[model samples]
Target: MPTGPAATAPRGDLWRFAALSGVYFAFIGYFNPYLPLWLSELGFGAFTIGALVAVQSATRVVAPYAWAWVADHTGRRIRLLRIASTAACLCGAGLLPTPGWIAPHAGYVGLVLFLMFMNTSAMMPMAEAALAQRVSTERGLDVGRYGRIRVWGSIGFIVTVVAFGFWFDRMGLRWFAPGVVLILFALVLACRQLPADKAADEGAPAAPPLRPVLAQRPVRWFFASAFFMVLAHMSLYAFFSLHLDALGYGRDAVGLLWAVSVVAEIGWFLVQGRWIGHGTLERWLAFACAVAALRFAATAAFGASLTVMLLAQAAHAITFAAHHSVCMAWITRHFPGRLRARGQALYTVLGYGLPGVLGGVAGGALSEAAGYAAVFWAAAAAGALAALAAWRVGQAAHKALSATES
Candidate 1:
């Protein structure tokens, strides 16, 4: 059901792009779970673990836009994507041997800064920017289709996570770094196959200034609500795996729970076209924010149970996937090609960089003091406020679009 980049691509680059995402995200699933796991095994606690993960999210505050500016103005999106991929591979490759040397002597604090932030961090947003070109700019492409191609990433996530869990059970975590390095190299290979965008490259149709469009009220609210949603969701990224591991869950089970969550994300990608087509942007945001509140609350309320945790995480479809598709469509409609990169950068800086950092820091403290339950309850509250912002945003978006049409 999913169209490849080339199908929409003037050159049939659809499958190639899909491969790119699949390989990249596969590496993410392959290694990310082990990041905190490694820290814990090395004798760090929840608070310290949180501090370590912060570097990764904090880097987005600067790097994505910095790289995106180059992609946009330089008309070197493909080349940049390739270079970034190669850099990421090199970074991941470097981490493979560091555990034997720097991890014990130099310490995880340094490695966290290096591995999470410096190496594997910038891969996703840059790749998303290029593949996102396939979506409908104005009306938007069918949302349901994404589930198919995106599912490969989920499959990759599931396979590696489960495999690593089993492998670690028998052998230990030493295998994680090597697996991650291999996956990054796979991504580089995939990037080599992606089709070039002549329009984005040849500088054919330039969109207007991003600053002017972003200056609008609804757009401002759009970002504010998005930031809250990401902030609310950050706890899962911060602590879900650690909590499970502490509760006596095996490595395999931990990976399975994560796999289930991504499956929900995959489902959302598949049906996004059908689901988002029915609602106005404001209503979509409202639903996603409301869902975010409930999901976090559910995690807080019955988090000790694996079933409850899986159910809550599965809400990733509405909370994350739907939220993203709507935001992408909104940007495409309101901003032009020239500034889309900047618009995305603003989205990254506000929604990702600032709130993500806050969420990581606060999640650590909450997990340490109030326990995981209270941490999730606060995230739920953040989602409620985000929903309110979306209500006002919906009203503004409708009014703005009506004015434009009239």
Candidate 2:
């Protein structure tokens, strides 16, 4: 956010931003798939693990916005990123067993996770806002440039998920907390490499109120679609590891399955610019949601078959990578300039936060009562709803465009 020379200087070193993204998501690759497994290793029940995972969602509901608002007003996103990363690293250390100090009890572990997630959750929104400013143009997001940079995150995730998957398999999950701390420490280092500029608009007029933007029909439908799509994905984020484990899949196989999805995701991100422009963003969102429906259904019904599981994982190219690109395009269009950070935060809150909570708590109960297959079935239903909502978003956008051109 630095003015003039300082602001322009960092543009030359885009890899710094890429590095930040890679390291952060690398942490995610391990944490999301393995955290529940670690808790289970510590003798926690499914419902308890679900509730603890919900802690991350609960913080996402408000923390990102709070951090973004401060960054928007102060134009110090990099500084905030450093603070969040450092704080999260510190809190992650609490997960380590230190005699009577850091017990693995539910109350103790839950609090540590809540604080860690609260800080870590803000990183992506702030980083995206900063990166988008660098890569976006008057026409829209520079898909090629953005894709080239963002692909590193996929690379990072794949590396860690596969490596840690094998590591935990060979050794044990007792080392999980230490791995988490190490990754978080790396995130702090990554943040230090980013440019230290503040946005030039620190003294500019206040950003337009967000309510009017929210009132637009297209915007409403867009959020609704995101909500359901991400809600459906919670099955993967919250329970995919446990699901495979329950079915007797080895930890190495679980990691390989996760890596397969990221490989597909990486392929899509590297070449998305070529295909993203072939269809409207809304149309793409609709397609992604439709694929999500199929993907989750396949995951639920045929999870026992390795071939079917591999095919389903491969669909991450469409279900996550493409959907993410389209959503970023939509958000960049809807909230330009000073509004960017808050816009990203709203997406996190509505799309991931609320649905994550519902998915974790409710999916836990459903999985406990009916089994993991039932949870994925419910996710498939959410995906179907998301497809319908995305279609409505396309309709609303077309109608609005027509009104304006007329």
Candidate 3:
């Protein structure tokens, strides 16, 4: 870990950090729900859309680790963050020319978008590393404080989702690209205002070799479990709205369903600090995996029922929020200093990027063959496997803790 001058960094810096975080997630909230719609507006077929989205996930497999390595070696996280924010904003603006410049050329557009999103995708893992460092070292703060700041990101996401849904309904998809550009610029300004970390200036210690870290049994299990858990999410993330529409729900209703899940996730972020101290990390991970199993199973079985859907959506608190918090906590414990960024990148690659690419492709194929219901059932099986992995993690952790006590 890099250590140098430590003075009271202003609380305002933390708040600005929160703002930056919020702006970052707002981009995702808008993109996740709206990107396919925007692509379809350009007359691309479903297969083309799936292929293009896979390009984004494919980039993620390399982009975040590449960016983190540069930041860790150069020790200039904020500078890199600013560059990424600016580039992504410009990319968003480029998509907004009249007559829909990129829309008419779907393959060309996908190529350009793949590059743009790759640049943008590194932001989340980098931001987490930054926040974890500051939260751990700064006075009058702890890991719990990180959640308070992160909740704003969820709030920002909700704001954009609701706002874009309404505007897209009224004015049409033409406004989507420009709206994203405006938000990205706002993110740039927020990034500029973030507090400087002295550790980045002092130079991070050389990270230990990766093989030993991966060789750790807990780390291996966590990654395996995360991969399966995210695989279970493929159907929900990619086709939930279509499933709802197929069952006779309106656009507004679909939006409301998503909002409910996000709201539940936010609630968990706000309250999870209290829960964090109450259980072992392995137990929490197991609980999250179990809930994920239930959440996917419920969606598979009762997706069309409004009441059951609401209840299943509420499990987002456990499925995503609790799972994420425990995973980050585990990483923070295992990987410190220069290693934090790499650890986060590894988590994102296996936990999100790999599953996103594989799951999106597989889910698309399976849904086409068997129906959307089968997709969720497959997701349920993935979640069950994740639960099994988590249980093993818990067993190993409990044995370790017992050995330490003895």
Candidate 4:
């Protein structure tokens, strides 16, 4: 195993990280798209399902930072990753109804999910922090190398989404709990494969204060853009499957739609290195948000048309994959070395956490009241706002650069 930067890391070590990403996202692939459907099958209303799904986001609000603080301070990221994945696997068993297990009542289910998410939610930030340390350079993240490894996540997602779509279609969603447990078990095993290195920062100088970094104008605008961009995505994450199902789409069709988006996402990650350098990360972020607006609008207005939905899903290349790469680049540049873990955690909190809570709950109510289409309309509006914020990020970054140069 290479103990140095990702550039110097052996190919096998990089592949291990790729394997971990693949399995971790494989767990997410089935869980995100199917969890609501499974809950609905258990007779929970849309509002209840939304709230339950929001439990994961709720954990993201505080859990990642808490975990990151420990990782940063102790430099025990891989150890924590293993522990978290093991805990998540154990918590996942609570979802099953073995003899004497509690029934899948709403409260019981929510509690189990909450505990499970508390562990699982922390895994990504820790893992990303570790990986970023390898791939990042003084200039920024090595977009191509990073994308090559990250692309495995999209591959895992698509594989499970499509396969389990067929599985649920044939075997019924009663198997959802078992499937979750199995994936989590896989996650635990993957974590065990990661090389355990000693603390990188032991006896090193103290990291700079975090507050001053947060105070920068470009950072503020960048987070603002992330908030709205993810807020826009919340509609899809929380309700897109339900929306398709409500429109009479079958489980197989719903899964295929999701797979379409992942396919596009995979393609972008595979080639993003070539295109990402053509413009500034901030500019790319703005373009991605603009595409997000258009994507959601199509889903809202023409969701019943498979062709339109497929086209909309294809834009995931830009809206999700590209946007994520840009954000990773920005985070790598803004928060380097000792601050890396917390920076990724903060992105989880502001970018995905708060927005997810709002989008899930509000979207649920909006779907229950006006219909699922209304939620997408609102998401479209949010995407537009994200584009504006990202544009401001570009302006702020340029101004900061000029001031520094002068």
Top-TM-score candidate index: 4
TM-score of 4: 0.97
Stretches off by above 4 angstroms in model 4 are 1-6, 98-101
- Whole-model Cα lDDT per candidate? 0.72, 0.90, 0.78, 0.91
For 80-115, candidate 3 gives per-residue lDDT tens digits of: 888888887777676676335533676677666776
List model 1 lDDT by residue over 337-403, tens digit each. Answer: 5565666767777888888789878888888897777878999999998999899898887788799
Count of backbone collisions within predicted model 3 = 0
Please, what is the TM-score per model?
Answer: 0.90, 0.96, 0.92, 0.97
lDDT of 2 by residue, 80-166 (tens): 999999999999998887323565689989888999999999999999998888877667777767788889999999999999999
Residue 285 of model 4 has an lDDT of: 93
Best by lDDT: 4
Error of 4 at 181 (Å): 0.7
Cα deviation at 322, candidate 3, in Å, is 1.0
Scored by Cα lDDT, where does model 2 land? 0.90
Q: Ranking by lDDT, best first?
A: 4, 2, 3, 1
**For model 1, the run of ten residues with the poorest summed lDDT:** 1-10
**Candidate 4 or 2, higher TM-score:** 4
